[model samples]
Target: MAASVQGGRIGNLPAEANAFVGRRLELAEIAGLLGAERLVTLTGPGGVGKSRLALRAAHAARAGFPGGAWLVELSELRDPDLLTNTVAQATRLTEQTLRPLLQAVCEHLSGAPVLLVLDTCEHVLDECARIAQELLASVPELRILATSRQPLGVPGEHLLTVAPLPLGERDDAVALFTARAAAAVPSFALTDANRAHVAAVCARLDGIPLALELAAVRLRGFSLHRLLEGLDSRFDLLVSPARPRLARHQTLRTAIGWSHELCTPLERLLWARLSVFTGGWDVEAAEFVCHGGPLDAEEILALLASLTEKSIVTRDDEGAAVRYRMLDTVRSFGAEWLTGLGEAEAVRSRHRDYFRWIARQGEAEWLGPGQRMWAERLTAEHANLRLAIEECMTAREPETALELTGTLWFFWFACGFAEEGRTYLERALRRARAGGGPEHTLAVWAHRLVTVVADDLEAAESVSAAYVWLAEERRLPVPALPLTGASLAVRGESARSAVLYGSVRQAPAGDGGAEFFQLLTLAVQAYLLAGQAAFERCAAVAERLRAECAKRGELWMGAWGDFFVSLAGIGLGHPDEAVLPAREALAAKWRVHDRIGAAAVTDLLVVAQASRGEEELAARLLGISRRLWHAAGLPQLGRPDLSVFHREYERRLRAALGDACFTEAVRKGRELGPDAALALALGDTADAPGP
Candidate 1:
């Protein structure tokens, strides 16, 4: 079952960078179709400008859809199974529940009028159809606009066949070519001398937008007459029998082939090597992975520049670095050539090596002054990291997969990708189970420790036995003693605290920053679990860790430290003393983007506030806590015993305030969004005004 949710809102859509030429008629027809039908698919071969036309129409129709129009680009996504997740991510659905994601999506769009543009659905046609069908059936106000090389053929799908640009005397085809040429050569124009030659080039290319654009780029280096002459040779070599297939597909292939024919050997080799990359890449990455054989490391940048100039690869100048990406059509063409050359595996191996190095560097640098920077960097490289895992799996190199997964544990933990991380970890474990040896043992323990934090007790325990046995057999020092201690403490198992964390009070200085902070936080929790007798000692330890975290600028860890210290104060019957620290920790957790942590700590803060007789504020916080818990896909988190105070505190608040008053206060609190709640928790009440 899905929980109640706000109406859907428009997510992100890529900005149009260049002038969109001549789709007025098609755009009007697409807009009309979308208004009259539930599912409108713009079908045509790739490079026939289906994507550009659809995006323009969607952007223009945004105001008509009250909930807003959203675009989900499928070209970079390879796994069809992730179609739902990809869409959910694009829509920014953060509900991490046991309910099916589809159900969550339906619940989100239940009463909203939203237009979803599924771009480049050809590769995942069936999956896209299924999703559109399901969403439309469940959400009466939801509409879908999909673009593909062929029809989705789902019932009630209105197909708008996207044809090539009209090859008339002054149609879109010639206009698009002239515009691109002017950009490439500022002095170039449609003069009487070269107009017929340009028209002939466009005609031979079947009036395909992609082909004409490619031809125009060549004008920067070749005359119009030279381009037309060279195009004939390439088209002759690309000739195929007249079959019932896409003319633009053939035209696009020939254009891509002609571009390849025009490239220098080094540029051609670099293009083929660049195909291994799923997303864009920097010159450093291209140099490292694509350099070898005839392509010298020194020549990569120059060749990359040449390819960018020719428009085979586009460059994204992101302040610090200029990254490059080939169009999906171009990348696919290059990938086919790479495979035919029997160098696909070799290229992929290089990619995996480069990414492995990056993962290790990130893991190493994640603990100090660069913690936040490293987090952002890893998040940006996440797609490429996934590709590395795929490469390892494809090569049947489970050990490499294990190494990469183990190294990325900190990233997953800090960034809240627990679910997706678990998927990769399990896949790696299965492949490594046969003869993984020591690395396998380490991976198992790492996986177990992460599971405990993700609130998966069953999976945690299932691996706990294996991890313990392996540690004993291998005589490997157990590095996650604090995690076990925290689990026991939250479970009210004070008796086991001595065995779990008693000897690890001052974990060796050699421990990485991630391990040290986790150990410190969990140790404090264990101390608190010793009941009132250990309150003073727990508070002291937590305060020390909090001070250490402050010194190091670790906001997230400091939040947990404050949480432990606050609990200690509450355990000592000083609930008022707990309020400040708990509120501080709640604010810090939200700042760190730890939603689950924020939710868990908010309950404690609410209790502390109520105990101090701040009935209204306490009731409001309780409502916010409810929303946080619901957003995290749980009624509660951590050990069930840890919820005792949460239940008791709410009970007390309800008694102090009448039921109706409590309900009204909660309604107000629920209005505090994630950002506003954090602001209120941080004592920034000006922006989070009460309803």
Candidate 2:
């Protein structure tokens, strides 16, 4: 549910999707607890609105945390081992170092005033508690707000029990029902004629928000009187004889079950199958994974619409695209039914297979006009991809898992997820080796390339010799040759790197997508040229690469091309010519969530400004670049060639401005958020210091 704010920092919290009808008192109390307590847990039964309240509270408290407020949604996450990595990603803490992921996250957060919201932690209670305890112990100014059905049992945890809405005349539950009822049927209202019936229905459902919402959807089909009568009969039939005291959760479950029973047979089938998805999914995904046998593929859209009308599925139409999701409680109910039908594994297989196709398609089309679209699409489906990978691993389909993970190397490497890619690749490689499957040579090389980008040279080298031998034995062209050249450049082997890059560029276009390889080759070649002090040649090659990217309508590689052009211009001592390309690269990189690329360009901007004798502005830009590099988990991308330029520029700026003035300018820049820094770089000058 995280949304990107253009020109600003990425917001980890979900935007309010709809009107919040009630809970003024609970909100006030939570605001107070957050003021005094470091850890506040909102405990309640399922569908009692804990997540909604927590999100609202986090948004209210966001301004207090200069480090930013982040929400780590744990509901879709199945593996307890991934908790730390998931949290780190939510905080935008990339890991390109050899340190443990937790240590990296703690280090990134140390001394920062951050509010971390761990939503839906019941499934990973023990792990969540462990992480929370460690983070609290390490970060002095950090606060945590967690939502779970029960307490996490961590020290210094304050529990706030969230109860069902008070059923008073104008209380939350009735107001919630009325609001949802109006949405269901615009002409519907709480009239004098049906006031008693509305109150009867709310009382029947025990004021649970989810139940009320579901019941409100019935308004489109049934009269208020008939709906009340239906709920009365349904509730009585659903009560368990063993537990005469109908618990609150049981009441909620009965409501969901009643809604399920009312769906058409096809709608019910699709509902159960759709449970295979972890996060929200789109129409294409649902059709692919949920259709078969009794449910025809062509009927999926209509069935999905029916399910949405019945409140079994919720639609998100806020953006340009429409997506759908079920409440966690509703999804759980469908999962139980899915397991009962013995179709869980089959549906999950289809889910995995569908995402596998997505990975393959993304890889196939990565070098074309659809590059930006693929990047955005894959990012949207990231949770589903992770779910599919988990399913493959759970089924012991390591070969398939490796193929899927390997095909997504571009996503992991170019889209700011190299660290996570390394994790999945390592796991798949281990499992594939243990399974005694065919030596997946392509996947092995892909893993090595990702490791190199992640700054794990030792791991990258481990597979180097074997991959080369295998590729030659099988007569397979090394598709990763350009990246191999990049690896050499990172190690300061400019001469050798240039030779490799030249061979890749000169090779005839083969079946290995040579056009893509050539693009990469040119990028690295330009870098090598710049490092070797051939500024004019570097600029010429980079301009050609940028023009190619423009013709192909590609943004990711085009941004890199712009970066190199700017680098060459700065190196050639034409600082004025460097500024536009630097800004262009930063904007494009930010569009694709390429933090490392943006950081690199920001660093280049510093040098360009310094060479133009704008010493104070250069110092400020330097500070901004430092923060960006830290967030990216790499200083100068851990590349010695780039680091050398960074050091030289900083030294020159410091000498020109002297220590005190330079330090003050950098301090001001470091305090600015991503939005401000970007504005300053783009010549807004509003936040610039006076001379």
Instruction: Compare the candidates by lDDT and give the number of the best one.
Output: 2
Q: lDDT score, residue 485, model 1?
A: 49
The runs of at least 3 residues in candidate 2 whose Cα sits more than 4 Å from the true structure, single-residue gaps closed, are 1-10, 191-193, 240-244, 318-320, 434-439, 453-498, 501-517, 547-551, 639-661, 684-691
lDDT of 1 by residue, 602-670 (tens): 887786777677788888888788766655556566444555755776678779888898878887676
Score each candidate by Cα lDDT.
0.73, 0.80
What would the TM-score be for candidate 2 when compared with the true structure? 0.91
Listed in order, each prediction's TM-score against the native is 0.81, 0.91
lDDT string, candidate 2, 133-249, tens digits: 999998888899999999999989999999999886666777889999999999998877877778888888889999999999999999998899899888777667887657899
